[model samples]
Target: MSTLKSRLDVVEQKISEAASNSGRSRDDITLVVVSKNNPAQMVLDLAEIGVSNFGENRDQEAKPKAAEVALAGKTVTWHFVGQLQSNKAKSALSYSSVLHSLDRPSLLDAVGKAVADRAEPLDVFIQLNLTDDQNRGGIQTQNVLGFAEQVLQTPNLRLLGLMGVAGLDVDPRVDFDRIRNSSEQLMRLAPDAKYISAGMSEDFEFAIASGATHVRIGTAITGKRPY
Candidate 1:
């Protein structure tokens, strides 16, 4: 098997094992292969093998890469998974069907305007700031509910629960549990918004155990980023 195919198989097996351990089915989780710095060809290759969801972090990269994949006639769901600049909302919205980093009011407003006339509502996750870092990209735990309320009110945006990154040195399940708690709280407001977007290359197993419905994994399956 090709290295990419081998790596993908291993990740899928691990995901299946994680889901089984969590008392959930493998189908319950959506694996978003983060194609941030990876090339479009890699995405196309994966798509050909039934990987329908791919994630990109930068508008500059995603724009051209998405275009390339589209031009090649491959159909894939694009997820924008990085901190977004308000001014780039239009650009990002143009290609992504899902935005995994909807964190602030300014971004919400920008996205609202950008998708006002689109035929489909953009699926979004309210990013959570797990730490006390003021410079971090997500909304703090205390403010996530209010922000989620705002996202629910916005036109052309579908709230998809919470997205977070566990602190590098801490146990990942701690952060994953926090995300699940927040997701439960969000569901009290909008039940359909119960999907938790957490975990990555190193900690997806822990995330799955904590009820993460969507895991954004990259390097483990995509290989070392060329950049």
Candidate 2:
């Protein structure tokens, strides 16, 4: 087995243990292997290991990376998880099957315009900034419902759930609760949107206990991205 395969095995084992501790079935959680900044071969290595979902945080890098992965004849679900811009909407949407960074009215409008009349609507999550930094890519807590309503109004985009990352100084538990609470509020608005996406190598266990349906893991599973 490859060295990366060994790391992935360990990460999956840790996930199983976390699920057991949280009383949630391991199957209930989706592991989104984060491949941002990692080479395409590294990503294919993950695909070979049976990962169906991968997350990328940039448009320029992700677009070609995905194309290369496809050219190599491997298919995987790519998720756009970075701060999104209105200009890159089309290219970003092209590579991403699900997007975890839907945050503003303009972006909602841009995506609706970009994907309108496509065969499939894109799955999207409203990013809830667990920190005080507004520029950090999530809509503020007070604006989640309003933003979600915008998402619902936006054509060709399905509001899947909420996504968040803990702030540098914040506690993981608190950050995750805020994200889970956002999901609860969102469900009241749109019951079908029930996926809570959060956590990472450092705190996925806490996120699982707090009701995250999906966790984006990078270094722990793939090791550090080679610069």
Candidate 3:
């Protein structure tokens, strides 16, 4: 087996074990291979081996990469998993089927305008800032519900759930638990918005155990960034 496939197999095994230990099935989780800083050929290779979901954080990088993948005739779900700028909203929405960082009112307004008249609602997750820093990429913990309400009211935007990153030097599960609680709160407002988009390479297992429906993993499966 190729080294990439070998690494992928190991991560899949760990995911299965984590899900089973948490009383959930492997199918219950969606493994979004975070391909930021990696090449499009890597995404095509993983897709050839059955990886159907890929994530990118930057529109500039993702647009050309996504076009290359499509030109090669490979079909895959694209997820935008980084803090998005307002000006890039339309471009990001062009290829990304799911947006994991719908954090601010201006972004919501931007997305709402971009997707106006589209046939499908743009799938989105309200990112929750797990740290005390006000300038972080995600929504403040206290403002999540209020922001979620705004998301629901917007046109052509589907409120998926909450996404968060654990603070530095803290046990990951602590933040995962907080994400779960925030998801629960979001669900009360939009019951179908029960999905939690948490976890990365370091703490995905903890996130899965704490009810993460989507795990954005990089390096473990994609290896180190070239840059």
Tens-digit lDDT string for candidate 3 (1-227): 29999989999999999999999999999999999998889999999999999999999999999999999999999999999999999999999999999999999999999899778999999999889888888898889988888899898888989999988889998999999988888788899999999889988999999999999999999889551
Among residues 3 or more apart in sequence or in different chains, the pairs in candidate 3 whose N, CA or C atoms overlap within 3 Å are none
| Local distance difference test scores for all models | 0.91, 0.88, 0.92
Query: What value does the lDDT take at residue 56 in candidate 2?
Result: 93
User: Candidate 2 lDDT, tens digit per residue, 1-227?
Assistant: 38888888888898888888988899989999998878998888888879999999989999999999999999999999888999999889987889999888788888898899678989998888777676777899888998888788777888889999977687899989988887888899999999999989999988998998899999898777572
Per-prediction TM-score to the true structure, in the order listed: 0.98, 0.96, 0.98
Q: What TM-score does prediction 2 earn? A: 0.96
For model 3, the run of ten residues with the poorest summed lDDT: 218-227
Q: Which candidate model has the greater TM-score, 1 or 2?
A: 1
- Number of backbone collisions per candidate, in order? 0, 0, 0
**Which prediction has the highest lDDT against the true structure?**
3
- In model 3, which regions exceed 4 Å deviation? none
